[model samples]
Target: MERETESRVYGWEPGEQAGRTVGREYAELVGGLLDGQLLDVTGWTAADRAGGVLLIADLGLYGPGGRADYAPDDDDAAGGLFRWRGDTA
Candidate 1:
């Protein structure tokens, strides 16, 4: 007899670019923290940019505890460079 196993849906893998288009469209975090990190901005639009948006980043430091908040670096929003906002918890 075969034992039952659990299946899970894992989102973007580590170091994986979240966006569909690699370099064409995506949010990349620059500077000291989260540098070179790419995020999915598929549906993100100008309206969202005007209101400001917060993105959650998983640093993988200590599981969920390692997650943190980050926002677009307004100075370079067009460049898709984000800045470290603060810790999640």
Candidate 2:
């Protein structure tokens, strides 16, 4: 008997329509804690991209520990993914 395996797709791959926006005009987070978060980078400068960080609310925490900071993973920034950095004060 032959067995079938499921295939999974990861990350974003631009299509023909994406050609209009060739640069980092927009960004979206994938994987880890901040998955699916979209950001507008149309006016973001080089410095902004280098130092860009995101603060996300951690539903798992309460009070002062309720938020965390995330920074774009340099390895995956070209693909627009942010990784959890640390908990915010």
Candidate 3:
């Protein structure tokens, strides 16, 4: 998964809640992506947690341009994400 180019990271606040299962899945996904060095990852943060059943994990990822623009509405094309579409995604 080593990317050809370097990537950045960004954080996101779902503005609601991700619970535990979803958060764990998300964390695992992110951790895998990061460990594999897949693409130019952005929005990565050590604070991203997924332990409790009712908590908010401020996750992160790289946007289209390799930056956390916070514009979750931005298209996945602009970011490296496959289904990125704001917090609702």
Best by lDDT: 1
RMSD for all candidates, in order, please: 10.0, 10.3, 14.8
lDDT by residue (2-89, candidate 2, tens digit) is: 2222211112243313222334345555544445555556787777866866454555244344655555677874746556665555
What C-alpha lDDT do the candidate models reach, one value each?
0.51, 0.50, 0.25
Instruction: For model 3, state the Cα shift of residue 70 in Å.
Output: 14
* Candidate 3 lDDT tens digits, 2-88: 222222222322432222321222221222123212222234442322111111123434323332112211233333232222331
Off by over 4 Å in 3: 1-3, 8-83
* TM-score of predicted structure 3: 0.15
Best by TM-score: 1
Q: Clash totals for all models, in order?
A: 0, 0, 13
lDDT of 3 at 17: 28
lDDT per residue, candidate 1, 1-89, as tens digits? 22222211124564342334433346665543455655556677867644444443455434454555556687884746557665554
Which candidate do you rate higher for TM-score, 1 or 3? Answer: 1
Q: Which stretches of candidate 2 lie over 4 Å from their true place?
A: 1-24, 56-66, 77-79
In candidate 2, residue 82 scores what lDDT?
A: 54
Q: Which should have the higher lDDT, number 1 or number 3?
A: 1
- True-structure RMSD for candidate 2: 10.3
Error of 2 at 67 (Å): 3.3
